[model samples]
Target: MITLSAFADEISPLPEEQIDVLARHGIKHIEFRSIHGKNVLDLTDDEHAQFRDLLRQNGFGLSAIGSPVGKIKITEPFEPHLDRYAIALKLAEFYSTPRIRIFSFYMPEGDDPAIHRNEVIRRMTALAGVAEAKGIRLFLENEKGIYGDTAERSHDLVTAVGSPALEHAFDPANYLEVGQDIDSAWNLLRPQVGHFHVKDYCTKTHKNVPAGQGEGQIPRLIADAVAHGYKGFCTLEPHLVVAEKFYGFTGPERFGDAATALKTELNARDVSFA
Candidate 1:
């Protein structure tokens, strides 16, 4: 069965607000990107423990740690970034979660991606290796402007690494924003997808929209995923209000709207989700 989760941080920087809105929508898990305006990776040990307690008390579980582990520029020094990645791994263990969402490193603006293909693979391979050693799965998201933003390159990077610990966290809105045909991207990358990010984007308006109200083809993707026996988290990441490079915010009401839009599409397809 498909399960529901979300970037609750989109609802509010306050943990209580995030949890409240999610609970109201029947979402019991969160993607755990940030809380209190700080990214998950930057949370202090005490902060992590406190949040863990709060989640447990509220009967919430973590679907994944929405980490920015691989969002840095490709040209940045790798050693320090690798050190930061270790923090993400620790967060996963802290939350008792096996999954973490990540990105392919961004290519320099105006540069040909082909020239950096080897480096991207090399970095991804390294990241995958660390996760594999810890028995954690890294879900690589196709963020706009990243090396694997397109299906073909995403496929290439994943295949080149060839690590079972690495898989796709398919984001239809992201692909749409990058000008990829959703159906075609899905056809190519579906087999590797281990998670889904439920959101939609309008290429024409260059804005984020509630699911099924934009060109991301949310309904078709959901129907297709169900038909293919896909069973995993459909994590809502609606950037309906403020879409930014490192994060986005939808506030409480808009987050609820996005949640309803996704549920509407799922109900139309008779898909079962928690």
Candidate 2:
């Protein structure tokens, strides 16, 4: 069965509210990104303990640590970012999840990503080593302006890293935003994808929409993956109310809408989700 999870903080900054919304939507897991307006990497020890207790009480497991592990610029200092990656690993263990979402570093604007390819691979390799040592899987997300933003580059980074610890976090809307056809990107990255972020994109309006409402072609992707026996987390990352570089907001009601949109797709395909 595909497990249903979400970036619950998109519903509210408060942890309690985040849990409440997820429970209401029948989502038993969360892609833990933030709580109390703080990133998961920045959560203090006490806060971590408290949040764990809350999750335990609410009967929620974690799908992954939604860490910004590789969102740094390719030119930024690396040692500090590695320390942050360590924290993300710790959170993954604390939550008893083997998954941590990451990214390929951003290339300088207007420059060909090839110029930064070697550096990105070096940094990614270093990170993958840590994940491998810790027995954690890193789901490298393809984000706009990032080196792995395209299916081809994402395939390259995953192949070059060549680590069992590294895999792809496929986001159809992201590919659409970058002008890649969703079907083509899916075909290219299907073998490497270990996670999914459920959001749709309207090519005509250049806006994010709920699943099946736009050009993302989400239902077909879901049907295909299920037919292929893909069992994994499909995390709802609805940027319905606001889509920003660092964070997004959908609010409680729209977050519910996003969940419904995803559930509808699953239902149409006769797929079960927990």
Candidate 3:
């Protein structure tokens, strides 16, 4: 069955309210972005315990920890980031989640893509080693302005890492952000995709749009993944709603409008957790 999970950030930083909204929407799974008023990697043990308990009581599964683990400079040494990854792995174990979402660090201008790419693979492999020991999967998400922005680059990174613990958390909208063809991107990364991110974007205006209303071929992307035997959570990452706050520096009212629009689009697609 295709289970739908919402990205907690879509509902903002309020856990209690987020949980209530998710339950109202019939969503039983969630990919958490932050915890205890801190990034996932910065959560303390007590925070982790409380978070785990809250989700358990609500009958919600922690699908993955949206860790900002590797979304730094690719030139920087891996040791500092490894420490963050350690914490994230521990948190995942605490929550009993089998996976964590990661991002490829941004490479600076004039930097050699080849050199940074190799470094990314090396660092990811090391992180994968930690995940292997903990029996967890490290899912790399493609993001604009990052080294692994395109599916081809993501595939190369994973292939170079050469660890089964590493997999792709495919986000089609991110590809659209960088002007890559979404369908081709899906074809490139489908084999290594362990999870899915349901999002959409508009390239002409460089704006994030609600699912199914933008250039992202969401239905076709899902169909392609299903054709490839992907039976995993089609995680709803309503980034278009949150992008204003995080990117455009918009207000809460904007978030409310975007969320309502998102819910409407999801309904039109006949996509629901219930």
Tens-place lDDT digits, model 1, residues 29-148 = 999999999999988989999999999999999999999988999999888998889898988998999899988898999999999999889999999998999999999999888999
Q: Residues 105-220, candidate 2, lDDT per residue (tens digit)?
A: 88888999999999999999999998999999999999899999999999999999999999999998888888888878999889898888898889888888898898878778
Model 2 lDDT at residue 73 = 90
Q: In model 2, which runs have C-alpha deviations exceeding 4 angstroms?
A: none
Task: Write down the lDDT of every candidate, Cα atoms only.
Answer: 0.91, 0.90, 0.75
lDDT tens digits, residue span 7-36, model 3: 765665777876777676667888887744
Identify the runs in model 3 with alpha carbons over 4 angstroms from their true place. 244-274
- Candidate 3 residue pairs in clash (backbone atoms < 3 Å): none
TM-score of candidate 2 on Cα atoms, chains taken together: 0.98
Q: State each candidate's clash count.
A: 0, 0, 0
User: Candidate 3 vs. truth: CA RMSD?
Assistant: 2.9
On a 0 to 100 scale, what is the lDDT of residue 9 in model 1? 91
> Which pairs of residues collide in model 2?
none
